[model samples]
Target: AQSVTQPDIHITVSEGASLELRCNYSYGATPYLFWYVQSPGQGLQLLLKYFSGDTLVQGIKGFEAEFKRSQSSFNLRKPSVHWSDAAEYFCAVGVRRDDKIIFGKGTRLHILP
Candidate 1:
């Protein structure tokens, strides 16, 4: 079965510090990668996605992710993070055949002053 893993359950970073949330997926063929952010009481927002064409994809809220096939990773990165950016990040993988998406456990980001 296909699965996703977000190694960090929680991450704390100072204001203006760079942030990186790891995401790894296991699938036989090429799978779709997605990054989503959910605020305290808000629905999930699509941060970015990598279906094809590009290895590095840009997302909303000044976020970006790089897809590395060899590593089977689609890690999200932000050069500088803000307090407003604090939220729960989820990495998802979608298979073409079943049209189903598998989500990770989720990583909660904490911003510090």
Candidate 2:
């Protein structure tokens, strides 16, 4: 069974703080992983993705992620998160965008003043 997992349900951090959101996946074959963010009451937007070649990929909104094949993890990281970065982040693994995109339970980020 191919699936994406996000262990954390919520995380809180102050403005201009470092952030790391964990993500894990189980797949039978080569995995195509993706990180997506969703603002309140809005559709998801792709932050980053890993298809092939590079192990570490840079994403939009100053976000990046490293793909670890040994651990099957693709954790999202931000050096200094802003208040506007507060959103629900979701991890996905699948064949393609229109195909079976298995998404993990999202992690909601809270920004403190």
Candidate 3:
């Protein structure tokens, strides 16, 4: 079985400050990883994904993540955050093609100006 765990349930950061979210996964082999953001009452949008190759992957909205095989972790990082960046973030792990993706409960980000 494959699973993903997001350590932080919620985070608050000041506007223009840096941010990081932690994620850990358990899988048999290299699995498809993705980070998504959802605004209030809105659907999720893909921030980034790691299918294969490169350990470090970049995504939209000034977000980036590094895949560490040894640590079984893929952490999201942003140099600076904006008020608009405040949203719910979810980390997912995709197994088989026909298998359903699993999403973490999500971390609510609050930005203070």
Specify the highest-lDDT model's number.
1
lDDT: worst 10-residue window of model 2: 94-103
Q: What's the C-alpha lDDT at position 108 in model 1?
A: 100
Ranking of predictions according to lDDT:
1, 2, 3
Report the C-alpha lDDT of model 1 over 1-113, residue by residue, as the tens digit.
99999999999999999999999999999889999999999999999999998899999889999999999999999999999999999999998899988999999999999
lDDT of 3 by residue, 13-107 (tens): 99999999999999888889999999999999999999999999999989999999999998999999999999999999988765778888889
The candidate that wins on TM-score is 1
Collision count for each candidate, in order = 0, 0, 0
- lDDT of every model, 2 decimals: 0.96, 0.94, 0.93
Q: Model 1 Cα displacement at 30 (Å)?
A: 0.7
Number of the candidate with higher lDDT, 2 or 3: 2
Residue-level lDDT for 84 in candidate 2: 97
- Once fitted onto the true fold, the runs of candidate 1 whose alpha carbons sit more than 4 angstroms away are none
State TM-scores per candidate. 0.98, 0.95, 0.96
Q: Which ten residues in a row have the lowest lDDT in candidate 3?
A: 96-105
Residue 79 in candidate 1, Cα distance off native in Å: 0.4
Task: Give candidate 3's whole-model lDDT.
Answer: 0.93
